[model samples]
Target: MTKQNTFLNDLRNEAITGVAYKNLMLKKQILEYFANISDATITDLSKGLNASIPKINELVVALIEDGLVKDSGKTEVGIGRRPSLYGLKSNSIFFVGVEVKKSHVNIGLSDFKKNLIKSVKRIPFQLTNSQASLDDLCIIIDDFIKSLALAENIAGIGVNLTGRINYKTGYSYSFFHFNEEPLSVIIKDKIGIRTYIENDSRAMAYGEFCSGIVDKEKNILFVNLDYGIGLGIMINGELYYGKSGFAGEFGHIQIFNNEIICHCGKKGCLETEASGSALLEAFKIRLQQGASSIITKDRPDFNDIQLEDIIQAANNDDTLAIELIAEIGEKLGRGIAALINLFNPELVILGGSLSATGDYLFLPVKSAINKYSLSLVNNDTELKMSKLGENAGIIGACLLVRERLLELK
Candidate 1:
């Protein structure tokens, strides 16, 4: 290396914390190594980074002093002395991750180790409230922080919104708005905590990949079929956020020229036919047509029917409920077939509340995929349900905050 660069590196090494490193790139590289691997030793880090043992040791010492990495006792080898194992200091700092849905918002907290320090708190609220929605969100978050006394330790808040979000710019174009100011700044001002926002689908994909669920899979598509359909794309083991940070709007894909109007103001979108709300609407229509079912026995008014009611009834072998789920699954598979042809992902993971229906939904989905997808693309893709489920967004948001913190100088 050049003398000036080397001198700068040496000078910066001793003058910065993990959260704000002078040799930021090197420090971030070391932290990323520990973040990806569990219980690594200094020897492992040196080998992993392809650097000298002495240099790696020096950086490790700096990290240890900064309270970022900690010693985890020792690892034993065959007939040899134990080597000290190091890992992230999981509790050194904390983050709050919030998932905003149409009907409610869910918040959770995690530490550096990605451990869920607090159970998620769900608050019922309407997103259409706009500025009032931000008010309600701040109130809940403020109460949560005060209740746990975590105001001092938290580094920032991450919000996963189920709307069009420009993650790089920290703006939710479709959800939260504050006089055109960035949502992150508005949130920080109101909640008294630095905040970042991402699209929910991207967050879920990130959470699953980083949280060790699909850690081994390089290319995958995470399908979240909740109230609406959302896709999280992982390509070559990295989350692919398109130039606009809005690539995963799989729900808005126009599939047919039907009269059904989508919330996106388009007609015959995938979400209108295959989402949780879609399933509920179809079930309500069936009930209105006098199709006999236990749901109708309890909720004679179709407006009273919920998605959970259909899932429960389907599990109990209710014919109407099972049929509705199967229909939605078939429609969902058509949309997914297009994704398979486009991305050719190795794994397609189905998540969200509707996915819990299991075989009742997946069977039809697979059938449709087989009928629609090219054999070459279909043969290599393995479809499975998301292991992360509801916690995917929350976990993803917390990890994102840690990633952002590591980028500081």
Candidate 2:
């Protein structure tokens, strides 16, 4: 090659590397500033990072170029000149969140701020336990992205499931036919973007944490009472995935020695007695006994009875339904008390479909915890309902993608 061409190529390479380094530094500063405070002025950020005014300006310009930060106009104080404020631009990018449940999958597209833009729900039957089924899921995901015109704009995909997950290696041991196949690799290979997998309950807990609630509590636990019970633990503001990433499998803990079997091939697990499926089973037995309950009146077709129907019956003063829920709540509380004694978390947020019953489930749960737990531990721990509701999984998934990308920087 000619001397001029070689020198020009070297200059171009140097420029690219310089831009990459500056971008990385700016991203780091933006994440650190946002983590420490909700908002910042360029002057404040400059002073905090010990960077010069011109350098700060350049960094902010680069951040804006990357769509990671934005200027929110000038803030006026009571007395002096107005100062410009900067904050993370939550809508600069988008993520896709997939929640894989035993019966169905919920796919949601969300912006960087974790706001759901669009969602699609598909039954498990549509996939039907085959290789082609996995392809179908990919098609559905692709369709959802195409619908939103986000095929090129998406940053990554997040998978939330009710099973053991290895975020580092991207393997899911608990759900699907290819138990050992890395879910992240499969999705990434098909979708052409990064993919992350996390336990559903833990994802919900992280969603709540990221939402800025429970800021005062560094140690918290989220109990999900769904098709089966699950636990999500956070300590010192970080999700605690124990060795093998199966730390919060609280549903499998044995609370009774009864002969009743659990899905995990165990007997008398906490979920066997306290989960929504268990409650539904109990409701069915009582209904068959000619129990006087409003649920029976509402859904004469026993096959159609749902968790909400029983909750509604209890709300309508159905003695059988109310008594049954209280019993399950007591059992759940006992399991919660065990958690309190073990971890001594500052707060326990009850989530999942059963939590929809509100105080109908919480009251008895509190009573059981108070009755069974040591006074010191009980006093420090507060039981509350999850603020995120069903959207928690999707939001948590988006947060996962954001967190991973930030870590890369």
| C-alpha lDDT values of all predictions | 0.80, 0.78
lDDT tens readout by residue for model 2, 212-304 = 356689899999888789998999988999888889999999889899999889898998898888999998988788877776666888888
Q: Tell me the lDDT of candidate 1.
A: 0.80
**How many angstroms is residue 285 displaced in model 2 relative to the true structure, after the best TM-score fit?**
1.8
lDDT of 1 by residue, 14-74 (tens): 4556634434566567777877656688888888878788877887777676666788887
Error of 2 at 160 (Å): 0.7
Give TM-scores for every candidate, taking all chains together and pairing residue i with residue i: 0.85, 0.83
Query: How many clashes in each structure?
Result: 0, 0
